[model samples]
Target: MSWQQTTLGEIADIVSGSTPKSSVPRYWDGAVAWATPTDLSRLDGKHLYKTDRTITEAGLNECSARLLPPGSVLFSSRAPIGLVAINTTPMATNQGFKSFVPRPELNADYLYWWLRANRRQLEDLGNGATFKEVSKAIVSRVKFPLPPLTEQRRIAAILDKADAILRKREQALTLADDFLRSVFLEMFGDPGENPMNWDREPLSLQAEVKIGFPFKSAEYVEEGIRLCRGANTMPDRLEWSDTRYWPVSDAARFAEYALVSGDIILALDRPWISSGLKVAEVVQADLPALLVQRVARIRSSVPAEKPFVFQCLRHPSFWSYCNPTETTIPHISPVELKNYPMIKPPRELVAAFGMIAAKQSVLRQKVEQDAKDARQLFQSLSQRAFAGDL
Candidate 1:
């Protein structure tokens, strides 16, 4: 097998898109899928099956937005470029995207994967200092190693299968998280439920609550102390990609508020959706770092009951208590949080909840590991395929 490097323009026709007038009702909402960069992030496969917004045929004619065919590749061109997804349906995109309709000799899937693997190169092509964008000419001139069409399909199928397995594992993780939440609710009534039969206690009585240090942007360095931001904290776990770092010199100021091995961090902002209230146990040896400002750290006063409280914090009932009233940003203040009450159950019941949480944590870890392995396998196959070694 022989491989050749050629510019995208040699094999595909690059087309730009436009949006229709907002005032025209007919063009505002129609059946054609309309895609944006945000939608690209949620895509599960090489081809996007649906989009958040749909445009009308009238809109297509009214604006420069063209109706791209099923196999055309879509790439973001503005703000940040290089994110790519294939269209599985006839769709139109905003000016932020540039569509590529491949020639018959090229495989759409192969092109999509190639673009993803070389995303950094595309980002480098961005010319603006403030907002990076890939010009149509620059995008068309980008080159890559291309194999025969037959090989491309085979390689794509292998990667697709691996990716499918990873997606299934991810779905399983979501279900497990839901089940854990259900268990927490069953053991303890909803946060709003005032169980007259059970003893009520302030959160301060059961745990030590402390706010994190105020970290200025200048204090952030490439790698030093692990820092937890609002984005890092989620409902049940911390998002690794959301983790940031701070210079070690700033660590002393946050030493008292540093997360212990079992402490839980909660975001205090409101409309619960945007708030990053979540329970993240400090598992990493070096992660005993401070939580950024706007986050509250909760550590169980009783060491044996830490996991139990962590589970309770993840319950939907708990979120109900913290969720703010009809406001644009849903949030609960530190004062409100300190006074929030928990229904005191028997010691055995608390232990049972802890056991369930521990089991769920194991399952979550396994699921994440499986997903990581699947991704590695897919990447290996992709590399071989592009190299004509498949």
Candidate 2:
């Protein structure tokens, strides 16, 4: 069964956003809540409580951005699109958003989930050479199935509960991550302090760091051996959802760059993100993948050192050493990584930590699988809800 077909503009007030002149000092840090795509991207849930940047009332008046009322659905239109959030407070956004103020019959949460569910469709509507952006006209013209007002609220409530489950699972994974970091600290004091008098050595002695090949985008294939690039790497995790592929026939040419379990991969380009260092250790599941440019693969000289080497890189202090603020581009160089001072714990202690790490890895894998399942469940719910099968 299908609900009434309707365009977004028919049921919502389409609002275009703009930025105030950044050069003016008086325009920033004011009472008005100014938002950008980054603000929406930073949020963990549907409701955005605050913004990273704010504008003065005078500044808001000087630009096209208007303060949207609470419950307005914000959809990021560019700089990587399809970020959706509902504002809990009045917010004004920059041009990257084509936000929607719902009519009395349209539920805000419903719109939020609908946009999220149909992200790929929305992304396909984007157009631009340098970067893709979905224009106000494009977003407003997009059609969706509109259920009755009561049905919308009910659907939103159900999705809300489902999303809460996903969040809880995510929280559990985070706690596991924290536990590993704490374990590292307990076994070996902070490398910055080196309180245990562990003999320090340059990372090159314990690990071989090799940068990746500059794989041309034109040669990318639909399916074959996967290319492991910076985008696939996160702290202690490799996300293969948006993976790129290389031709399997040519895989033998890059045999040296093939990833094996226990290898640590690091992103050399803008390596320091808000989420800590872009580093991950390859597991058995990540095998049969070849390396791509701007990503470094570190293999342990002594297999027992693998766990410690990875923890050293995952540490927050490792990023501090990068001093990203001083550099024009936030990057970690091959030389810097090779020369990184590593605190070498005693072999006995390293073996103990390795044992603990392996056990934790198994537990973390199960939790991660649960998290993946929860996300898929939410996606399925959204699809059925929108398809009127709920």
Ten residues in a row with the worst lDDT in model 1? 270-279
lDDT of 1: 0.77
lDDT of 1 by residue, 184-281 (tens): 66776564564536787888877888877778887678888778776677765667675678878767866786777778888765324433355466
TM-score of each: 0.82, 0.90
Model 2, position 78: C-alpha lDDT score: 94
Clash pairs, candidate 1, are: 18-65, 269-331, 270-329, 270-330, 270-331, 271-329, 271-330
For model 2, how does the per-residue alpha-carbon lDDT over 3-23 read when each residue is reduced to its tens digit?
A: 899999999998988999999
TM-score, candidate number 2: 0.90
Global local distance difference test of model 2: 0.89
What TM-score would you give candidate 1 relative to the actual structure?
A: 0.82
Best by TM-score: 2
